[model samples]
Target: MFWTGPLVTALILQFISLGGGQNNDPDVLLESSFPPAEPSLMNLNAICLHGSGRARYPASFFPPSGYAYARRAGKAVNRLEAWFSQCCYEEGAKGHGQILCCAKQAWEAALSHFCTEEFSTMTMAHECCQQRGEDRWNCFAKQAPNPSYQSLPGYLAPEVPPDRIVFTWDPYTC
Candidate 1:
């Protein structure tokens, strides 16, 4: 078992200062993880597939409270990235609005999944989960480690499975 001692702390901190390492394959998971630093969500600069651009801190980046949360969070990121990749390659003709819509759906779905997991545990759901609509997004926006996803100097993303989410083009949904 990996201990969250100074060594691990220092390692994660190093990742923050000098960019994080790849998350490995989606099917294969790391042994253990520590939550992201409290103040800044810059712990890892998550790269979306197909050049869709960097995303806010993904659930896979910091994850929820425990190891059990890792698989779910990682899957959520995989789906998000997959949808982003589709948006990048397939939705180009549809305009950014459609791309953004896909993103929003994936994001909210991830959060809804997170809230479900939270309640599954002994702990109460995160405060932001209690809100809905723009309020939910606004609450999450405030908790971002940093406002923008800056490049991690020389970090690169690994190849993950192109998991897909069901998305239909409905302008009203956006």
Candidate 2:
């Protein structure tokens, strides 16, 4: 778990390292707001969830000033992750390492969803949208929906033990 603690801290730092900081709320920072869904589950519930779970603090949240909003939002996410790490660590209890691992797994999973090649391409679209109108582009500049506790592939998916995979909670006892 100690490994996980440093690993998460490092990841968060790395995320922040990629961009400059802009004052914003970090707690509300979310990688993606889209919930995971099965291809077969295209039902009303899924649609409803999809509509309701759109990204928070989307680029639309900013004024139609310029790309400053996107830059600022990115920075805010970094700051949020940093703050989340500090606060969660403080409240991580006796098994702080385990908690770190959980958070790390969650973060990695979240990153995986948004930082993919497809997502990278979206950057171009976002930029183009910005050119069209910062206000309009803001609508497109949103983080993907967050991965749920049960939907994190790295954590929730079955895998071999003893390897560097996510740890699950044992229900029988603490």
Best-fitting candidate, scored by lDDT: 1
Error of 1 at 134 (Å): 3.0
lDDT of candidate 1 over 1-174, digit per residue (tens): 323344533444445333322343322232222111111223222323323332222434442344445555555445555555555466552655565565556556655665666667765566777788788767765654323332233334455645444644445766
Indicate the TM-score of model 1: 0.53
How close is every model to the real structure, measured as TM-score? 0.53, 0.26
lDDT tens digits by residue: candidate 2, 1-174: 111233443443443333221333333222332222211222223222232222223343343454443434443333223323332444342444444444444433333323332244524433323333343323332322332211212221111112122223322232
Could you give me the TM-score of model 2 versus the true structure?
A: 0.26
Query: Which ranges of candidate 1 are over 4 A from the true structure?
Result: 1-66, 69-75, 91-93, 162-169
RMSD of each: 8.9, 17.5
